[model samples]
Target: MSPPMIIAGIVVWFTAGSLLSWHARKNLGEGMIEYFLADRKVGGFISAMTYSATTYSAFMMVGLVGLTYSSGIGSLGFEMTYLAATVILMVIFAPRYWAAGRIFRLVTPSELLARRYRSPMAGAVSAVLCLVMLVPYASVQLMGIGYLLEVLSGGAIPFTVGMLIAAGVSFVFSWWAGLRSVALTDALQAVVMLVASLLLLGFITLALFPGGLPEALGSRQDLLKVSWTFPMFLGLTLPWAFFAVTNPQVVQRLYIPSSVKNLRKMILGFSAFGFVYTVLCVVFGLAAAVKIPGLEKADNAMAMLLSSVPSPLALVVSLSITAAAVSTMNSIILTLSSMFGRDVVRTFLPDISERTELGICRLLIPVITVVCFFFARMQLGLIAVLSSMASGGLLMQLPTILGAFFWKKATAAGAVSSMIAGGLAVSFMYVQGLKPLGHWPPVWGILVSGTVFIAVSLATRPPIDTEDFFSSLEGYIRDSFGS
Candidate 1:
């Protein structure tokens, strides 16, 4: 595809997104909740779409596609494991998140910890942890856009320009109407992502492989069997399995549904969407392997396939990928900014006004986006693991979230210690490239964090309101659903 056509498609797509943002903003209300959570009134399908778009970013179409193309069907199992874990976790935790968010008027997942453990430091530290881990993950999105556009446009768009375009769109959508605009645009992006990928798959199966994919696979049928080593597969799957609870961006989505019914719909709807989308991506990867065999680099599989497809179809898929990348980036930036304002800044200045807090969060959006853009410019070798690594690093927070609901003995000190130790463990291994005794870094991180959390809790006293906290949540759950 020519640079002119690629640029034209992006402009048209952005224009449509901008119109959607404007429409969302017209009905936006005032206050922190309204801005960040859309007044908790987003419909089921929109919530599902936003959750899907945010969770499955350019990673699905680009990285996951390439992963499947190179590694075969193990990628499918790894992703399906994540989807199954997410649905199960959602069923257990979404109601608690919704109930707590409503009762406490919370803005960030870190804020939930602050209240649950009765320690601002715990929330602040978790917020810091999120900021530290998620930037690289978000940067990988920009990196995807930079590489995708730079290669597809034959160097006309340039890498930096691609990053700038993504950063700019994300900042605008997130800043314009907060969750309202983000959710609305996410619905649009999700539709584009699914439709474009379907078209890509249809073309590959019907046009490229008239005999069907399984037959075309031929000797490559080795891909049909699971080949990933247990250590390799477990290491990759653990972080993502806990992603719904651990990642602040998606965890925050649990608080957006208007009612328990809508929340259930959101989870069920996401599960269904996830199943189909996951299968499509894995199949696309397999198709790429059959059609573009013997590529030197596996990551280049998706790019190679795009180049061979019709220019119009390629442009559509490319824009969808850009949408996926931008949607994920904006959600991360927004959620991080909210965490900063609510958990980090307020930890220092407890008396800050709502207006001032909202102002600080707004200013930080561009700041975060620029930081991610710079990281994208670095072209780090960590892009592939960055997603899982970020989630892994974030696995530190899982103990705290679980302790919040299930353990009365869970202490603020425990939450803080586990998060800090676990976060450090994950980060140290990732940065130094250490696996430590044949186990993944996250495996070590989780073990260390869980140990610290339990030991420290036994050593320290629970929050003074431990009993009341449990009663309140239990009461809400029982009363709201009559269980």
Candidate 2:
């Protein structure tokens, strides 16, 4: 794609997104709940689309496609496992989260922990941990767009410019109308991403196999097999399997559906969208392996495949990838801003007015975007490595999050101690290049944290209101979802 053509594509995408964001602002109301959760009024389709967009990101097309291209069917198994596990986790936790959010007026996931554990420190700790892990992950979205633009424009568009554009778009949507704008734009982006992927796959298929779609992917036979060893598969899938609860951005989403029926629709719709997108990404990778052989870096597989495509079609696909990045980034920024305002800021300034809280959140959106923009500009490491570390680091939170909903014995001390221990272990392993017994860092983090959480909770007294909390939560869930 030529420089002007790439620029035009970006212009069109940004304009469409801006218009959607402007339209969504009409639904926005006053206060933090309205700003952060779309006033808890998002419909099923938009909820599902936002959730899918927030959860998947450019990782699906760029990172996952690269993984599939390099590692074969293992990538498919890894992602499908995540999808299946997410559905199960959501089924168990979404109703509880929604009930809690409504009953408690919770704006952030961390706030739920704080309230359940009766400790503001728990919310603050979780918020800090989320920021530490997710900022790098958010940076990867910017980096993905940077790389995509550079590749598609033949370096006529520099990486920094791409990062700036992505950050700018995300900031505009997230700052304009908060979650309302972000969710609406996400729905549009999700459609573009899915349609573009389908179109790209069709073109690649027609170009490569003029006769018909092949029963067997030609060449790279080894690439078609499950190459990930048992430990590798477990290590990779463990953290991702629990992503719904572990990642605050998606977890916060559990609180956004307007009704029980909408929540059900959100889960089912995301499941279908995820299944199709995952399959398309895997197929695209396999096709790339066959059509563009001998790529030194597997991460370049998508770029190489795009090079073979017609310029206009390639631009469309590239814009789709950009949309994926922007959709995810905006959601992350919105969620993080909410956490900063509700969980962190309000902890110290509990008396702050709702207007001030809303202002703080709006201000933090651009600040977070700028931080991610700089990180993307630095190009610290492989996008996949940083992204994986973020997921692995977040896995530490699963024990506390799940225990908050189900276990009466779960204590604040337990949650805090376990998170610190698990986070340190994951960080040390990542920093020192340690993977004991061929297990991933996330595996170790989960094991250590689960043990620590149980031991500490057992050693400590349960919160005084634990019984009441559980009883009320259970009653609400039963009343709301009839489960």
Candidate 3:
């Protein structure tokens, strides 16, 4: 595609997203309720799309492509294992979390923690970590969009300018409609990304390799199989499985379901879509390896392959990548705003009116946008870098959440210990990776954190407040014996 055409296509897509966002904002209220949970009125299809879009972002296209380029077919095993984690989460936690969120009118994941654990400090800590961690992840998405624009526009758009544009669009939508705008835009982005991936795959396969995808696969037999050991699988999937339950952004999706039944529908639909989408991307990655050899970086693999392809296809793929970036960034902005506005601000200043808090949320979007733009300029690795920081913290939350729903022994002290220990471990590993330390951070963090959580819960006497905490989750089991 011509540079002008590619730029024009991107502009058109952003315009459409902005229009949808405006409509969502106009229809939804402007208070914290609208800003955070879309007033808890999201339906099944929209919720499913939003969840999928947020979960699979530029990371899928840019980051995973990079992984494939570096690891060959071995990366697909990691991806499949990652998808399996999502499956486990949906089957085990989504319905219960959705039901409990609705029943209690929970606005944020921290609020659930606060209520369940009967500890405001626990809520504050969780919310703060969520906001802090999410900012970088959000910035990474913004960075991805900037890079895509820079590539597709053929130097017409600088990375910084692309970051500005993407960040501005996300801020406007998130500022205006909040969660409602994000969900609606996410649904649109999901369709565009999935279709674009399929189209690009078809075009690349037919035009470049006439031997068929099977032939391409046959040549890289070793690359097509799962080469990692069970230990490696556990390392990757164990923490990732907790993402749906523990990721504040993901947990926020559960809060907006129109009803518990709708959430169930959304989970089922999203699981199927996630499975198919992940497989397609991995297939695209493998095909790209065969077609475009000797790629420099894993992050640039897909982009390089797309650019090497026919122009029109490249333009379409670039637009889809941009959409993915924006969708995830928008959610992050909304989530960050929620964390700061509701969790931090309100925690410190309980007297602040809800209306004022909403205003602060609107203001925080631009602040986060600028911060993220700075990081985008740093040109860091997108997926792997960000995931390593979060995988441990999210995994910690998984035990407490799952235990709350099913296990009777989970204590607030245990939950808090687990979070602190797990978060520190993840951060420690991240720091080590940055330094000249040895190989990949052993999956010991997960094992160590889980052990600490169970031991702490069992060893420490339940605080006087523990009773209230147990009382909070009663609604989750109410359905079994008639509330």
Q: Count the backbone clashes (under 3 Å) in each candidate.
A: 0, 0, 3
lDDT of 2 by residue, 1-483 (tens): 789998988899889989998998887789999889988988999999999988888888888889988888899999999999999999888899999999899999999999999988889989989998899899988988888888887898888998998999999989998898899999999999999999998897777667654554754678767789999999889989999998998999999999999999999999999999999999888888777777889888888888888888888888888899888898989999999988899999999999999898888999999999987787766544666688899899989997898788899999999999999999888877789999989999889999999999999987899988898888998898887
The prediction achieving the highest lDDT against the true structure is 1
Model 1, 1-483: lDDT tens digits are 899999899999999999999999999988889999999998899999999999999988878888898888999989999999999999899989999999899989999999999999999999999998899989989988998999998899999999999999999999999999999999999999999988998898889889888888886988898888888898999989999999999989988998878888899889988999999989888988888889988878888998889999999999999999999999999999999999999999999999999999989999999999888888867755565578898988888888999999999999999999998888788878898777799899999999999999999999899888888888998998677
> Looking at model 2, how many pairs of residues clash?
0
Q: Distance from true position, residue 11, model 1, in Å?
A: 0.8
Error of 2 at 147 (Å): 1.4
lDDT of 3 by residue, 361-385 (tens): 8888888878877876777675447
Candidate 2: Cα lDDT at 435: 90
Which residue pairs collide, candidate 2? none
Of the pair 1 and 2, which is ahead by lDDT? 1
Error of 1 at 167 (Å): 0.5
Residue 61 in model 3: lDDT: 81
Cα deviation in Å at residue 319, candidate 3? 1.0
Q: State residue 422's C-alpha deviation in candidate 1, in Å.
A: 0.9
